[model samples]
Target: MQADSDPVTSGMIRRLLRLVLGSKGYDLPFKSDTDRNFLLLLVALMSFLAVLACAGTLTLHAMTQRWSSGLENKITIEVKAETPNGEILSPESVKLDTEKIAGMLEGNLAIKSYQVMNEVEIKKLVSPWIGEDFSFDEIPMPGLIAVELSAATPETLETLTQKVLSVAPSARIETHREWLQDILRFVKTLQGLAFLVAMIVVVTTITAISSGVRSRMAIYRNQVEILHLIGAPDPYIARQFQWHAVIVSLLGSVIGTAAGLAVATLIFHLSGKDETALIPEIGLNYGQIAAFIILPLLACLISGTTARFTVLRTLSQMP
Candidate 1:
């Protein structure tokens, strides 16, 4: 049995077995390590950015839904400066009108609760735009009331609007539906932009991998041709490049994803501390965290596939 088993044939079988077992037995003797390191760095950066973008999109979507739901059943009633007689109402008259409207809202079955904002509260609301030192007595500020409804419908809203106008003809009723629609549109637009950016990142990553594979193939042209002459199959050669790409991309993406998670965690903690932050409580849920963890595997798959296809295509075009 030992005599029949030729040493050269046994060595070939061992190499093939190693290849099948996912070992890098066919690495070329070229200095491609730097190229691979560069590829890893680029992929890592792209992956990090992609994760942040996805997280932002998801957070914005959640925020939009929460805001929309909260405001859906609420309306704002603005008591204007002018009364029904087209004459400017005094502060006392505006106060009386506000009281009268509050009484009407209390009697209405549609209204769940209503609050006539006091002058101090209105001043606080305008303090951001107009200086706190600005006297409200010198200017006419509309009396504002926030109303919550048990059931907000067209008929209920119309009846409420008419009652408010009768009590204070200059009063304007505003439902949040239109504002919510605008906000939803804006959020969707941002999501679309984020998706576009992600697609660009994916395409750029594939292109980078393909280019690196092509360059490496060029460097190993002589060895590859000798392998082809010796009956080595295209898939075996491609697997060498594919596995390299996979290893490099996986390492880079993992590093990148870790960095991204760190950033997201920091932001979540910081933003949570400040209730007035633009993205308060910006953090991934369990499902989103799972998706984020899958990013590295996806990057590896993409790079491996790109490298294999690029090597095969380049070899096919060779004489």
Candidate 2:
């Protein structure tokens, strides 16, 4: 029983080694495993760039969503009118109009809370942009309401807008929807750019990998010629080169991706506590990180396959 168990354990150990480290079939002219290591380095660099490209796009989307949602529950009401003589309206009449509009809005069910901004509040907002001295008293400014909407149906802003219009025909409703739409448009453009960047990275990476494998094969021409003379099949020779490229690519991808995540983490930590910048920092979040890990393996597989085909096709055409 002990003898049998020893053989079985040895066999299991051998299988495990092969699975993790790959089979050492041929010792090439290049220093021990240099070819595979270089392939991996190439893969890692390209994949790292790919992750950077992906992160940029995702962060932009997250930031846009955050901003849009932040303003999702708030709206502004402005009250203003042109005088009949094509001049600015009287402040007293505007104030009166603002009161009537506020009173009407206060009775609405969709409104969660309402605050009528006095001259002071309006001036406070305008101070930074224009100047502190800017006042509603000096300039015929519109009366504004800072409105918070009910959680159930914030989109029903149209109904509330109509109600305000009924009370004061000249009243204006600015729900931030247009601004949100503009933000969304900007986000969409960013997403488009991200997609384009991702595509370019993939194409460039694939090309780099294919070229590297081809170059490595060219160096191994003499060995391949000897193997062919010794009656080794084309498939066998292809398999060795393919496996070497695959191993290298796989290892490189793993290293590059890990570095990418680490850099993202460092940036996230250094973002300062402002919290207002709202940068969409990177995190794995379980399945998300796993997806990135899987990508490297896929890249390796693709690179290996390309190398295999390129070598076999080239060999087939030769005498």
Over 1-319, each residue of candidate 2 has an lDDT whose tens digit, in order, gives 1122333323443343357546743434433334455565677887787776666676666677677777788888888745545578888988999999888877678888889998888887777678986556678878888888875254586677778888887888787778679878978887898788778767776677677657776887888888888887888777766666666666677788888777765665677444655354434345555667776877777877887887788679757
Instruction: Find the candidate with the highest TM-score and give its number.
Output: 1
**Which consecutive 10 residues in model 1 have the weakest lDDT in total?**
1-10
lDDT of 1 by residue, 1-319 (tens): 1222433433443354356545544445422246866887898998998888788788888888788778888999998887567777788788888888988878677889888998899998888788798776787788899999998889989988888988887889989788679878999999999899889989999999999899888878998898877887888788878877776687789889889878987887778898755544667888888888789999989998999999899889866
Off by over 4 Å in 2: 1-38, 72-74, 81-93, 118-121, 133-136, 148-159, 229-231, 268-290
**Each model's Cα RMSD:** 6.6, 6.9
**Local lDDT at 274 for model 1:** 88
Q: Choose the strongest candidate by lDDT.
A: 1
Candidate 1 pairs with clashing backbones = none
lDDT of 2 at 28: 43
Clashing pairs in 2: 40-248
Could you tally the backbone clashes for each prediction? 0, 1
Cα misplacement distance, residue 80 of candidate 2 (Å): 2.8
